[model samples]
Target: MRFFCIALAAASCAFADGVGIAFPQENALLPAVKRTYVIGAIPAADATQPLTIAGVTNDVYKTGAFIAMVPVEGGTNTITLTWGTNTLDRTFRVAFPSPPKPAATNTPPRDVRKDLGIPPDEEVSDARPKGKRIEDLTVMIDPGHGGQDTGALMPHGAGEKTVNLLQAQAIEAEFAKYGIKTVMTRTTDDEFPALYARPRRAYAEKVDAFISVHHNSTAADRDPREVRHTAAYASTPNGLALAKAIQQYVGPQVTGVKNAGAQMRSYAVCRNPAVASCLLEIDFINLPEGEDAALNDADRRSRIAHAVLIGFLDWLFAPDDGT
Candidate 1:
């Protein structure tokens, strides 16, 4: 059968006959694997026959959705899809897994400190409040997703919910070093707190700050490799200040990832008017590199938690403009 070639970068190309591929966007770089699934749809009006990819037949639903597993090699691979009399081709690259490099020390770049106006010799105690005792300060920590609400999942089965809890616990441990008390929404993976309840808990505790820890994920249509970064979001003035502090301190700790900067977003867990709240999107966990550095690396996770603690401390010590 003659096949019409679609550009590698195109997520879907509509033809006169109404056949399209919906996922594994064009020129996408995927983890090195022997097989991968291709998902797409044919117009229901034209779905007269079963769809096949790489010679494997896939059952098309009544709505025309079809998914089929196809074999791929270490380099560029092509997938051929056939339905009825139409044929289409999609090409993507499967990146070979790189050899593990020697672990590097998790040190924040000197420029990061300088940019934040912190001297190299400064200690956390130096930023302590003047009249207020550190022991009296309290903060609320909300790990983003839990239980069945697994925020994002990698191909190998690691869930973002587990990573969020781990990072939150690490941050809590760091905060403890300064005598700061932290209240977590839920300490275990089995507990799933409602989104609205997270901010309510922060307000009820009268905490000095609220931080919701989370990892990011790219949309199915986007290239995961192009969207790895650190971001923070806030809804109110106080939240903005807290988010900016996080962006300044935690941004550089992720090493190669770019800091996408603090943005204004009214996320459910960060909109508490009574408490300074910020949601930290540590990195895009959908990317393999991001998954390894942000989720799997224990030392890197601890360093990120320490950076977050430092950022919160800095925010607490800044002069209040009475917002």
Candidate 2:
């Protein structure tokens, strides 16, 4: 495969590798994220043959193959991929923008994809045949709470909704660079989605993956049972894997991210098997600090989005971490 190699030595030497897998500003995958990246080396003489990568499909990658990743949709996922004895023995994460919320459409459209220097457009038909494209995928980002329902007020005066939308837009930019299709749950700052309607949209869109993005609140009035580390919930076996991927990937990338792990909830949106579903409760929005940080800064936000992307890719093309 002709990868748009990022020329590792060429990227602007970046900050300390504080986050998950660190890359200089020019990793090939980051730049041409929309298209698959074939990150491989000639199998070492000792390397295993018919090398297999199994995390995502629970199957194997053909022999003498390079790893491929598609970063169109944003969400964390876990999968086990192996390539013989000489394998990609590690967890890989692709940075994707966050799911959209009801108010983001109006947040001053910014071309995040451009800022990131992601790959340019070269249209190609989705490899997925028709109906299976049901799994073909469309991301429905739901940034919980809006005009009336304050998702969780951040300390520095940022609203959870704002953070959700901002992150969603960022994720969208990443997806666009790869030519992935997407649908936002909302684009305005005016109304709140009905509690029930939020998940309903994914079902209607036939979204292959559904994600609800919202920061939690420590509201005394809010459910006291809500405070926890980074939490995710899913609907099926695949969904559980996805949640595990996110939790595992995000913890390494974000400084304060706590692993809430995966659980099956009775959420209406998560129950549908047609699409893989997850709700990411990122930190306590009610905390004055989380609120401020979720917004205001671009780099931190970038890390969050990147973590999700990496987690999703890890799940989709999960690397074999020799247990």
Candidate 3:
């Protein structure tokens, strides 16, 4: 398989002693269960060496093939394999499905797909064949705020929540063209999940990436029209790659959109340690020009979304650990 071939090639550069990862392959996405195991092999001559994984050294086999079980954490988990003087590590995500929340007054949860003008039947369509790069990858798209949370409103009363949803839908459609599956936190203007639930939903889906779409706003006391910058935030290094990709690929596509650049922030959506995530402020909607471009222009929204798509592709194909 391609995964094994790539993994073997990676193992080769790190060691010439015939050490390799045989199972759970590299960059494997595992279920978010309580415990999981990793399997790999080393030279039979060196099988007697004590091997440690994620700090657990017991249960490691001495028959060349080594297997160790470790506890799973929500979001992303890095498993480190160390033996003798060499060490190898792989990063993977563990996403447990979100448990059903009790319905208020016995009412079922709202189905926002229909409200968002998306036919429920069209939610999962396999007619569009998957692309090789994004196949088996999932991205959770969170539209910043909804319902009562209007977010940053323009002077003309244009709501930031609406613009966020519009841009998210456009981005989701672009990702769809590449056969990538996407999950949305809120599909309609009326739907509103709690602030913390946004990223939590991404973790539950074990999504490969999490992106929160929002428009920036300045203090009400200051002129909102003065800000006209595009900013992206990330917490992890991999997340930063995603952030920078957007800044590099999408920032220039929008008129008057200055690349404020990608930054590190503790925002709730991308703050999870396990998920590679980014939060994008395409433009400051409070600025008249920014609002017109980001909120009203369909072509501009599409271009920005396309740029983000390109950025993600760049990150996925980038070299890993100098490999």
Q: What lDDT does each candidate get?
A: 0.71, 0.50, 0.68
Please provide, for model 2 over 1-323, each residue's C-alpha lDDT reduced to its tens digit, 9 standing for 90 to 100. Answer: 11122224433122112211111112222321332222232223313444343334221112121333423323332222343322233333345644555664567743322332323462311111223332355666777667877565442333577888876777666665655567877776556777656655555555656667767654222322244467778756666666667666556357365666667665554554445667777665443334445665667666766677676655656544210
lDDT of model 2 at position 322: 13
By TM-score, the best candidate is 1
lDDT of 3 by residue, 1-323 (tens): 22222233444344433245543445656555666545456555556778788897744334355545567776777777766666677676776667878766977754433333334465331111124356788888889999999887653354689999999999999999999899999999998898767766665565778889999876423444345678899866767877887778766556456788898887766665556789998887654455557766899888888888887777667665211
What does the lDDT read for residue 168 in candidate 3? 98
The lDDT leader among the candidates is 1
- What's the TM-score of every candidate structure? 0.61, 0.52, 0.57
Ranking by lDDT: 1, 3, 2
Candidates 1 and 2 compared by TM-score, better number: 1
Weakest 10 consecutive residues, lDDT, candidate 2?
16-25
Q: lDDT score of model 1?
A: 0.71
Model 2 error, position 73 (Å) = 48
lDDT of 3 at 283: 83
